[model samples]
Each structure stands twice: as C-alpha cells, then as structure tokens.
Target: MDGRRNGRKASRRVGPPTNRRRRTGAAAPKDALVEAVRQSRAATTGSRVVELMARRALVVAARQLLRQHTDRCTKCGSTFVTHEPAFVHCHYCGRMHRVANASLLEQELFEIRMGLRLAS
Candidate 1:
C-alpha cells in the first residue's frame, strides 16, 4: 500500500463533510450589514418600498457604527456625545474633542447619517 501504516488500507469514513459549501477561500465582506443591504436591494426590482427600506437600513447601520466608534468622551468621560466633520462634542460636559480625520468610508457613512438627520 502507498504510505499506509502496517500495509493496511485507509478506512472509509462515513459522515457528512463539514460545511463543504462554506466559502473558506473566498474573501469576506468588508461590512456584513452593508453587503446584506446591497443583496436585499438587488433581490428586488423597481419598488418604492424596497428603496425606502434600504435607505432606512443604511441610516440605522451608520448610526450604530457611529455609536460604537464614539462610546465615551475623552475629556470628561461622558457618554452623551455628538459628532461633526472635524470634532466630537460631549453634550454632558460641554467639551470638544478633535477627531483625527476620518477615512473616506467613515466620512461617507457620517454624511449619510447626517443627511437623514438633517432631512428630518
């Protein structure tokens, strides 16, 4: 036998292969939520409801990202915070913290979030 121990053939294992369909070699999505929204939009044809829902989902996602990214104030450790293009302001302590210029992706998300807020 070829490379078999003690001249014994390998036993045939009997069981379902573990996650054979799972994309082990495929590149993961940059943002799962964003990719999900894209898929949802793509799955539907021209429909006003779907378009509105997609926008709403994007706004909600951006808000969540902003919240996670700005958890507490640096100056006074306050949780009440707001963000602008250049800085983050702590509402509770009235302190301004300069934000090291956001990435292009971040800026786009912030713009989407702020646009929604400003529109309403």
Candidate 2:
C-alpha cells in the first residue's frame, strides 16, 4: 500500500473548528436589545418635546395679539388680564370679558393678510 494510493483528501476550504463557547440563556443578546429599545424611546420623547414647544409658542403669540387688540379692561381700565377658555378675565377687577369665537380670529387674521397685501 503506497502512500499515494490512499484516497482520503483534506479539504483546504473547510474552516478550523471553533473552541468558542455558546451564549448562555439569551441574556447577552437581551441586553443589546434592551439598549436599542431605550435609545429609540429617548429619540421619540425628544421629538414629542419639540412638538409641544411649537404648539406652546403659537398659543403665546395668539394670546399676545388678543391682549393687544383689547388693550384695556372695560370694568377697571386696567390691562392686566388672564386668559380662560373662550374668555379673558381682568386681574384687577375680577371681571370676565367674552372673547369672540375662535373662527372670528381666523377671519381677522385673513383680513389682516389682505390689508398687508393691499398696502404693499
């Protein structure tokens, strides 16, 4: 039996056997997944905060314009007022002033835009 006559050939393309240990009880993968979830939640919360801030800014601007248009308290002639639902209350005299309907504000804004266009 010549050595060349033996037919078993080692495959060079085969990878070496691994001595690496298998993962234990999915705990390591779970930690990575938990971190990913936490990061995604943080990103969403940041976006929500930005959205809330924009809405607050719009409300403040509208409130300022309304206060300017009605620049005096009819009861006490004082300008100090606080906004409530569909009304503005005088702080100095405990009087309630009825604001126009919300749609009326939209109409007023439209007329102001038209006036600016005509002016230009």
Candidate 3:
C-alpha cells in the first residue's frame, strides 16, 4: 500500500491535469472550438484577397493588349472604333468601315455603307 498498484508506481509528472478545461480555466469547449474556427477563417480570407488581386491584374493586362491591337478607322482617320463581327464603326465620323480580315461571305453580307448623319 505504498502508493503502488500492481507493482507500478503512479506517473511522477507535476503539472496541471491533461483536460483542456482545467488548463484554460473556465473556457468552455464550444468557446475553444469557435476560436479555432475564427483563426482558420482569417487564413481563408487572406487567400481570397490574393486571388482577387491576381484576377484584377489579369483584367488590366487584357485591357492593355486590346488597346495595343486596336484598329483605326480608314474613313475618318480616327482611332476610336468599335469592333463588330465583320466591320468596325468609327464613333468620331459615325461611319461603319469594312474589315480587311473579314471572310468573303461576311464582307458581301455586311456591306459598309456611307457615314450616318449626326445630330448637330
């Protein structure tokens, strides 16, 4: 009866109990789980921010490429043009210009007529 059971002495470790409640002091299990969830959510939010920045960068790069490869209007000598399937429309001159790279079928079907009269 010298504090020994089955000839094996008890553990000599001197510290608080292994239970989380006793170590944390009055914090419930639900509170600890909630805290862990909050930390994980913060990490997820950080990754989402990085992904959004990457998407914005890609959008900016696409816009730059479009600006570089824009077509100029031959009718009005204007660079501000809207690209269509078979032709490009010039906003400055109000004229629909034919595209040189269009297919022959599209070229014949969508003919570029004279400029439209703009309201003064």
Candidate 4:
C-alpha cells in the first residue's frame, strides 16, 4: 500500500536493465588472430633471410675455388674451358658448379697466378 513498497516491487519485477550502448572496449578476437599471423610471417621472413645468406656464402666459396683454377674442377680436378659456363662439368666427379662472386674470384685468381709466378 505504501509508495516505497510499490517502487521496490516494480524494480524487482523488471530486474536489472542492461546498458545497450556502452562500448565493450576490448580488442576483437580477429585482431589477436591477425597479430599472431603477423608474428609468424616475420619469423618466416627472418628464417628465409638466413637461408639466403647461407646460400650466398656457399656460392661465393664455390666461385673463389673456381677462380683459383680456371680450367680445372675445384672438387675433382677435371679440366674444362672458362667460356662454357653451363657446359662445364667435372667428367670424373660429375658435379655441377656455378660462380656467383666474380670480383672476389678474379682477385683470388690473380693472387694464385702471382704466387705461381713467384714460385717459378
């Protein structure tokens, strides 16, 4: 019968009302998923860079050896011409080789040539 009693009954009947317009202020799950993808891509790219560097180093070493002996295989001592780059093959060993760092190979070739001249 009292006003306070009626207000309490009305509040209890309706229960608590939820706010429909309040921002959740939390990052979406998709955003976290995207961040994870980005991190994975970065890791993959870093590993690829390392792999490329190793390949380059191997190529440089091979080139240096090739330059040291123009007509001979570095691995098996088979003879060939410098002009035929692709056709060059170690007949005895049958290994394929390629030159990558031409400048370094040339320098090494010069050093070896000079050393042989001095030795003679």
Candidate 3 per-residue lDDT, tens place, 12-88, comes to 76797676443646657898888887789666587544435588888865543322224776566788888765566
Model 2 residue runs over 4 Å out of place are 1-69, 103-120
lDDT per residue for candidate 1 within 1-120, as digits (tens), equals 474767787666568766556557867676986777767854465445532558878876554343334668866888898766655768998876655545656655676787844533
Candidate RMSDs in order:
15.3, 24.2, 22.6, 24.4
lDDT: worst 10-residue window of model 3: 111-120
Judged by lDDT, which candidate is best?
A: 1
Clashes of each: 0, 0, 0, 0
lDDT of 4 by residue, 1-120 (tens): 554664674344366787767677976799898888778966658654433558878876766444433577767776743423223446677765554434644544655665833433
TM-score for each of the candidates: 0.27, 0.26, 0.26, 0.29
lDDT agreement of model 2 with the native:
0.62
Name the better of 2 and 4 by lDDT.
2
CA error at residue 32 for candidate 4, angstroms = 6.6
Clashes of 1: 0
Off by over 4 Å in 4: 1-33, 38-65, 80-83, 101-120
CA-lDDT, candidates in order: 0.64, 0.62, 0.62, 0.57
